[model samples]
Target: METLANLESFVRSADHGSFSEAARRLALTPAAVSRNVAMLERNLGVRLFHRSTRKLTLTEAGEAFRNAISGSLSDIQAAIAGAANGGGEPTGVLKVSLAPTFGTMHILPLLPAFIARYRGVRPEWHFENRQVDIIAEGYDAAIGGGFDLSPGVVARTLAPAHIIAVSSPAYLAGRKLPAGPADLAELDGIVMRSLQSGRIRHWTMRDAAGEQIPAPLREVFVFNDPAAMRRSALLGLGVAMLAVPDVIDDLESGALIRVAPRWYADAGAISIYFASRTLLPGKTRAFIDYIVDAFKQRRLAERFAGSLG
Candidate 1:
């Protein structure tokens, strides 16, 4: 019988198409992973991967074997994790991916309380600005907006991903106050470039009265990251459109002032995503519950709604 380690090596190698990447995920040496896979292939009496110097390609039999065992393998791993935790108490490394600014501002603040409550679960968080594959990358969960729901993953919304225009008080001091979104074009704009599309992002601002207007702020500065755009706006360089959750504290502290207060953009909901497994690991479940409950208790959903502005 193949050991779990061997199966894991094979699956992760197949998932990543590289022994090095699988080794990185499994915290094993590339040689070890390759050896484990070699052992599995020897035991099965069939070559699984067509190996080249650059990448590992699955053979027909290997593809069939992977398909046969992928779902069962996930369930087995989850079951093993659940069993290791005494069937209830959450204990393990909780790997999570999060958008940098939102995670630092909102989710990171909740960590102290989370760790205090579930001391057994150690958080391994990656603060990044891109969407991650939850299962393929071995992430327990991820927090962000606009994730394409892959198979075997579910998203639970935590707050509205509403966006609003903001600027430093010093920058707005001498400028004419905008009455509507169209007037924003007269001001210097701090804009974000889409990392995926390589285009400057623009939004249509909508009022509660159902009126929509194009926000065409003069593009004086452009950045690839939202955090940089927010920083530029905070420096009184220009007006920036930023997510409410990101700039809420700055707005509350009078560092950033809302421009055209009645107008805002509806992006979507900020959501926590996890695998839709029948047997979820206790640490992941605990994290999901804690974050969902905290958001409700704090009423962050209402506060993040840009339409309320």
Candidate 2:
């Protein structure tokens, strides 16, 4: 019979698409994980993964196996953990994925209070600008926009990801201001490329009366980092469409000014993502509640809407 170690190795390897990543999560060597998986395959008499130099892909049997046991494995682990803790305070690592700029500005501030409240929880957080496969990557929660809602996941809206055109006051000093979204084409633009898709994204701006205006933005600089783009705009490089939350401080302090005040692009909601489990882990539950409460107290949703003054 396959031992629990073999089962865990197989599941985590499948989720991560590589033995190295699975080993990192499992705290084992990659060779150990590989050996366990190979042993499991021999015991089961079925091939599970398609091995290649570039990437690991799941076989038909592997897909069927993953679908059958993924949720069940999560439940079993949760049960074991809960039982070990004896329904007491939540303990263990709480892994989360977050966008670098937004997480540092917004969520990182709440950590002091949250840690003070829940001493048993240890946070392992990562900051990046791409959508992560939370379950496969072994994250307890994630915060971002434009993520695919995979099975057994739930999301709560933290704020509106309203995007607005902004530039340094110095850049627009001698230039004729834009009368509408189309006028932006006359000026230089600082745009961002999607880290995941590697695509230069475009936007359709919305007027006060809710009409869509095509923004044929002209790029003066392109960056993969939003913070870098904001910094470039501050240096009088060009105008850029950025999330309102990202530039709130600059807007208030006169470092950056809105180019098209009455227009914004509705990007989507910044959401907090976690597994949808009947018996949710205590640490995960605490974080979700804490963040939602913080948003309510700060009225972040309203501020992020990017409404004109």
**Highest-lDDT candidate:** 1
Lowest-scoring 10 consecutive residues by lDDT in candidate 1? Answer: 80-89
TM of each candidate vs. truth: 0.90, 0.86
Best by TM-score: 1
* Candidate 2 residue lDDT tens string, 1-309: 667788899998887799998999899999999999999889989999999887887899989998898787777777777888788888889999999999999899999999999899999999988888787777899998888899878899998898999999999998999988999999998998887778887789997788899887896689989999889989999999899988998998999999979999988899999887766787888889999999999988888887553
Error of 2 at 3 (Å): 5.7
- What residue pairs are clashing in model 2? none
How far out, in Å, is residue 98 in model 1?
2.0
Off by over 4 Å in 1: 1-3, 28-47
lDDT of 1 at 149: 99
Per-residue error (Å), model 1, residue 76: 0.7
lDDT of 1 by residue, 10-78 (tens): 999999999999999999999999999999999999999999998799999999999888888888999
Question: CA lDDT of each candidate?
Answer: 0.93, 0.88
Task: Evaluate model 1: give its TM-score.
Answer: 0.90
Candidate 2 residue spans exceeding 4 A from truth: 1-6, 16-24, 28-62, 307-309
lDDT of 2: 0.88
